[model samples]
Target: MVRGKTQIKRIENSTSRQVTFSKRRKGLLKKAFELSVLCDAEVALIVFSPSGKLFEFSSSSATSTTERYRKCIKNLRPSKQMDDSQHFEEEVAILRKKIELLEETKRKFLGDGLDSSSIDELEQIEHQLEKSLRIIRSRKILLFCERINQLKEEGKILRKKNAELREKYEERQLELSIGQQFSSLEQVKEVETQLFIGLPNR
Candidate 1:
């Protein structure tokens, strides 16, 4: 049936809105079901009314539909770790450019020997190189210092554990020594008794 062309706006009447929502929801679900059954295609739809009521439909169970959605979306997504690695590569490229400039300055300093004009240029290049070298040295020192600190911390922890183990080992050794002493005393007493029994009258 050809109904009158309706203006696309919010229906002011609550009852009319509710009626339209119900009818449209049913029609949408019907179309989805028909598409899935006739075309053998997977279909999913979720709807929420302005009143905060939820209505959902899927060709599969709710859990299966969510799983399918995840699979579909993830296939189109880029990995985060790969993106971060690319950023790191870009930073490395900038550092490479700095190195290239430093090398060029060095070649100019050497190939074109230091005259008055060359000396001025040499001094400028030297200053820039010193700055770069200082930065590089500082970074290297920091890296090594951090590594040394980590090693020292590890050594401290190991020493504490070694002290604990040494105490335990000494305690075990003392116990074993006491046990051996008891065993020796018992042996001596047995020998004494045997000697006394075999002795002439005292």
Candidate 2:
């Protein structure tokens, strides 16, 4: 008769647990040794018991096997990290150079550091300044022309007003002169009538 499969569970009793640990440890070590011998391979195994006792097995020298494992892991480290470091350094150098150029340009604009400039640099600066000066002078001339035109318009308006006022003044003077002449003629007629009335011979 085929027996039922055994149910696997942790042993509750401390003594039974310890006994199971011992048996399993031996079985694992024996299997590791058999596999290494049959396959002609290197193998290492280590276990620690609940009682703090150490157990180990190795087909070769354990220390040498551990050292070899460490070396292999070290060799497997990604080479990309070194490449990234080199790239970062190159970018930093480029940024530093850019910053230096910007500082020099700023100094030139402030007119503080021109002694070290080459002839070509001086010529370039002079050309740039001359271009700017030309633009400023052009703008200034345009503004002056606009102001002159405005003043001329205002002068024309003033002259027209002055002509109208002068015409009005001349008309007023002519009216006053005509009224004085009429008064003078009436006075002469009055004097003549008085003379005729006062004279005896008619």
Candidate 3:
């Protein structure tokens, strides 16, 4: 059967907890000693039990090792801070130079700082301006063509509407003419009925 993984929490039973602590403490000290020997390095470890008992290990004298550690940390802090400060200053200087160059280029483009410019530089600026003008003219022509096509479509729609209106008007005029002719025939019939010859009944 596969063993279950142990949960990492405080052991409830005092006896078990004590046994585990003792075993782990011995293992930790052994590992520290091996590391120092194999790597030829300075190593130190300190542990305190719940009963206030001190347990410690050091590759050399504990006092000397701790003092050396303190000195190394103290010496490294200032130099690291100085290095960061210098790096920040260098970055700021580089950015300032870039900004200055951009501003100078803008001035040259505006024809304000050309006293020191060479003939080649002036010719390059002129060529750039001509290219820009060509782009603008091309865009304008495209807009004009699009507008003309839109107007032509509108004219076609208007002509179609005019033809429809003319057809409707002609139909209405024909209906009126037929109604007038029918009314004239009805009047003639009435006049003939009224014209009886020479007989009067009292």
Candidate 4:
């Protein structure tokens, strides 16, 4: 008869639970020991009952086997130190190349490395310089024209003010001249009357 699968629920009775724990613990230790002996492998098992009694088994010294496992895990994993060193070396190489490129460019801009450049590159640089110069000259001419126009406007205003001042001065001078003429005529008439009066009394 095919036995039905055992339902794997918790044994609720305290006596039954303790008895089951003892049986299972022994079976587990026996299996661990047999596997170690048959396969010539290191093995360790530890179990504790509900009352805190310890049961254990080891094919080799438990401490030695645990240490060996740790060493094996360490050897199987990659080294972070080596990876960091390699990454730093790669970054240094990239920075060095960048510094070299920047230095070369700086030398070119300062007109110190033209001999190393190709003819085409020199022509391109010359063309760019010429274009920049032309644009600068055009801007200078426009600014100068604007300044000249502004100065011309100022000169026109000054000329108009000078003409007005001149007219005012001329009008004052004409008034002064007429007053002087009237005073001179009055003096002459007084002098002639004095001479005629003195001569007629004689």
How well does each candidate superpose onto the true structure, as a TM-score? 0.38, 0.45, 0.48, 0.44
Cα error, residue 118 of model 4, in Å, equals 0.3
What range of 10 consecutive residues in model 1 has the weakest lDDT sum? 109-118
Q: Over the full model, what C-alpha lDDT does candidate 2 score relative to the true structure? A: 0.90
lDDT by residue for model 3 (108-169), tens: 88888999989998998889888988999999999999999999999999999999999999
lDDT, each prediction: 0.86, 0.90, 0.92, 0.89
**Candidate 1 lDDT over residue span 1-202, tens digit each:** 8899988999999999999999999999999999989998888888999888888888877678889879876876477657878999999999999999778766765655345446677678788778989999999999999999999999999999999999999999999999999999989888743345565986
Top TM-score: which candidate number?
Answer: 3
lDDT of 4 by residue, 72-104 (tens): 868763777578779999999999999998898
Candidate number with the higher TM-score (1 or 4): 4
Q: Compute the lDDT for candidate 4.
A: 0.89
Tell me the spans in candidate 2 whose CA falls farther than 4 Å from its real position. 1-106, 192-202
In candidate 4, how many Å is residue 199 off? 12
Total clashing pairs in model 4: 0
- Looking at candidate 3, the ten consecutive residues that score lowest on lDDT are 190-199
Off by over 4 Å in 1: 1-120, 188-202
Let me know the TM-score candidate 3 reaches against the reference structure: 0.48
